[model samples]
Target: MNYDTVRSVDPAVADALEAEVDRQGDTLAMIASENHVSEAVLEAQSSVLTNKYAEGYPGSRYYGGCEHADTVEQLAIDRAKELWGAEYVNVQPHSGSQANMAVYTAMLEPGDKILSLDLTHGGHLSHGHPKNFAGQVYEVENYEVDEESGRIDFDEVRAHAEEFDPDMIVSGFSAYPREVQWEEFQAIADDVDAYHLSDIAHITGLVAAGVHESPVGVADFVTGSTHKTIRAGRGGIVMADEEYGDAIDSAIIPGTQGGPLMHNIAGKAVGFQEALQPHFEEYAEQTLKNAQALADHLQDHGFSLVSGGTDNHLVLVDLRDSHPNVTGKEAEEALEDVGIVLNANTVPGETRSPFVASGIRAGTPALTTRGFDEDACETVGHCIAEVIDNPDDEDVKAEVAEIVTGLCEEFPLYDDDTEGLVFE
Candidate 1:
């Protein structure tokens, strides 16, 4: 983990890398989209395979010296297939967004219509946000969560799908805390004759472990981030029936990306192997339990959670009723200062801009990876509520910082070796 050679050659780069390691070690990462990969996965991601330019799929690369590349890539593909039960898997998209792009480019033409959830209501930008390439290339419409329930309004979605008659309907989310009804989404897509691309980017691990429902056999295409809840290093993946395999492979290769991130694929292989262990199921279950603890404790503290609760690993706290004056950014900053790091997120019916949203999103994947149990998570929830409620209070922050420090020490991330390197 020490960047010794880099430090000898470029101390400046080494210093920043060391600082990042320190940052992750010292602070709690509560971002719903983030997780801590195993040391083996980290080592794989930093492997020498990064030097290779296997500009095509395994055993069929445009370049020579793809033997090792073929071995690692096939392992990733096979492991992914075993994990998700997809007839075909593409481990070359580089990111979840790119995975979505591969599906879109492969299945639909330019100016094709897309129906997706609103970004403020938990949908991802890659689904159809105006700032993203999907929005620029596709005619997009959005469905929303029920204003009162904070769950997807299936009737409303069906109505919009019928009206828009989209070519595809994106069925995954970014900050949503509920277990999505992929079958229901497939029904709507089927009714409207639209393809369903279920982007289980956040719940990749949960879905893989069967803690969450599988979309692989239900949706027309399933896409996800290899990181996040999966802890498979950082990359993207696409899964589909064998029918669309060739198109997706083509889309990924000459379409959305050049060569795959082979090193990250190796990491994915290692992480997927780790996930295949019986313990990963326990870890996935614990992740959800910890999230429920956070949600329950926050609600107990008088905070309002969108959806009222959670079925997955994140809780979206809408501050509108509990602390109308406090913005999500303020809450995020306050929590970060106290060493509890999460993110500002848009709640349903948000009146504020995305930058200063009305809600905060926190998740348990990283904490659970650090071995946080429900009790520890409940304590984290208390610290978060205290800080969010009393952002300007040094006394509150100091008090919360102690709790965070204690938790970090009790569930230390990384080892005592190179990770003990100083930040500043």
Candidate 2:
């Protein structure tokens, strides 16, 4: 996986690039919002189309020489429409966060009110957190999940919405492990006369494959990351009925961004085409099964999962109950040292700082991409528990590293010439 051309151009940059490929090939990527794209997608993302400045939609571009760009972007839009069955889709936003931004700009005024899930309880920062532009511009209120169940409490949400009478109710979560009720959220939005934006960023592929409930036609607006569970290029998409189509497209173009990355659009097109295959459904199912196996095994080791169990591709382990002294940061660092990579996350009733959260979040999307099954995921769970239980023990780390090595060997990655972007 040597970057020969990059090495000839810049040795230092090439070294870093090659090292990243090695890192991914060797490590267990358990980050729920991350996944591995095919070599075909990688090639498309690195194509010469990067040099082209396509400033608008197909056949309506603000620039010249957009023939290829039109082809790629339209292909992406068509494939996405087919995959999600959306009446309209815009594959422009650079990220999921940006997709949320586009929806907000299109639907609400500056002082409009928004009701969203609390950040510590599985919501995204863009939902209403003070740190984001959405929070800065709009008056925001938050709803809570059922503390006892670690799931959304619709009764509370309805009550909160009734009082707040928000202009929008944002659904979708970053670290939630249970299946959400999209229709119930839509009902709440209806009663309150608010727009519904379902940010299915983490479960894009699952929803597309029918493993998770579809928010496409249920919500007023649906947004997702093209990279996460979708395994597409690095970008965001907004889907809605034909009524919101023009507004979203305008908001994305002159409102938010200027030029689109045609290369990434090409990648999105290629990956979406790949996802339409029958095997992708099998992949989505295995992703859920592997997550369930991991959650069960971790619970068996006395680790407390946020909701007692998971119905999706991730598990939220609140370390407070199992390891009273270990923070999620400590657990994450320990696991990473043993070649297992995930993230520290906040739990429902979080007391610790967000930087050093009360919980660790792990998912199966990347490992499932690497061909890992339930038994292998259970082994991963055992290794994770052992390491978190003994972070400073050299023997434990060495043993876990050996196990990770064997797993990587069995499910090898990029066994082709796609190393450092040389795809063939």
Candidate 3:
């Protein structure tokens, strides 16, 4: 974790970098979209491969001196294929949003219609928020989860699809707490004669480990970020059958991005290799178990949970019912003050501004990576309930902070003597 070379060259930036590492080591990361990658992944990302400008796929590049780039990129591609069982894979998109952009470029026109979940109802901005490029270029329609059940109503989605007649139907989600039935979305897309793009950005590792149902063979296109649950490099990937390989590759390179970040791809290769090991599945399963435990503890404590529980790594708490006066932002600040890091998020039927939403979303992937188990996650849930229940209590915040510090000490993340970050 030491940055001696960086310190020698630029002491100020080095200080910030070192401080960031220490911050991660000290706090509890409960953000559903964030994870702690292994030190091996860290080293690979900072390698000299960053100097290259590989503009195309492996063994078929648009530039010279790309042999090592080809090797690293191919290894990433191969491991991703093995992980997801896709016939084609593209590891070059800069982020999950860019991956979606490439999918749109490959399969859609500027004025095409896109039907996706509503952003406030657990969908992502890239799915077609009014301010995002996808919404500006595409005619977008949105579907909401059932109000009472907090789950998708397939009948309503079908009716919406019939009326909207979208050119593409996008599935998967960001703040969603339950497992997705990809085949149902595929059936709706089939009924509408539309293409299906399943964005599994948040559950890439769970899907790869077979803990969650995958959309790889079932959807028209599958895209994900490597940094989320997969904990690879900070980038996106697109997967499809070989029939759409050339179009996807060209769309990602010329239509969306310029050159590939070869160093990041090297990191992806190393992380993918790590994920292929047997213990990664144990980590993935533990992630789900931890989420369940957290969800149960929160619900038992009288908090309102979206979906009533979780089938994955996160639980979205709608504070409107349990704590009427407390906004998500207030709870977020109080929790951060106690060294527990999570995010305020929008829930279904949101009435407040997105910035001060009525809900909080928390996940267990990062804590699970730090070797947290079900009991630890339940304790974290208790800490959350405590702070949210008493957002203005300085005494409670101090007590919770002490407990968080003890947990961080108990489950240390990166050890200098160990071989990178390891999970038993």
Best by TM-score: 3
The RMSD of every model to the true structure, in order and in angstroms, is 2.7, 1.7, 0.9
lDDT at position 76, candidate 1: 94
Task: Between candidates 2 and 3, name the one with more favorable TM-score.
Answer: 3
- Candidate 3 C-alpha lDDT tens digits along 171-240: 9899999999999999999999999999999999999999999999999999999998998999999999
In the predicted model 3, the residue pairs found to clash are none
lDDT of 3 at 394: 93
Residues 1-424 of candidate 1 have per-residue lDDT tens digits of: 5689999999999999989887898899999999988878888999999999999988899999999999999999999999999999999888999999999999999999999999999999999999999999999999999989999989999999999999999999998889999999999999999999999999999999999999999999999999999998698999999999999999988997887889989999999999888889999999999999999999999999999999999999999999999999999999999898899999999999999999999999999988899999999998998898899999989999998988888887776743521111
Clashes of 2: 0
lDDT of 1 at 234: 92
lDDT value, candidate 3, whole model: 0.94
Model 3 misses residue 192 by how many Å?
Answer: 1.1
- The lDDT per prediction is 0.92, 0.93, 0.94
TM-score for model 2? Answer: 0.98
Positional deviation of residue 310's Cα in model 2 after best superposition, in angstroms: 0.7
**Residue ranges of candidate 1 with Cα displaced over 4 Å:** 417-424
* lDDT measured at residue 3 in model 3 versus the true structure, 0 to 100: 79
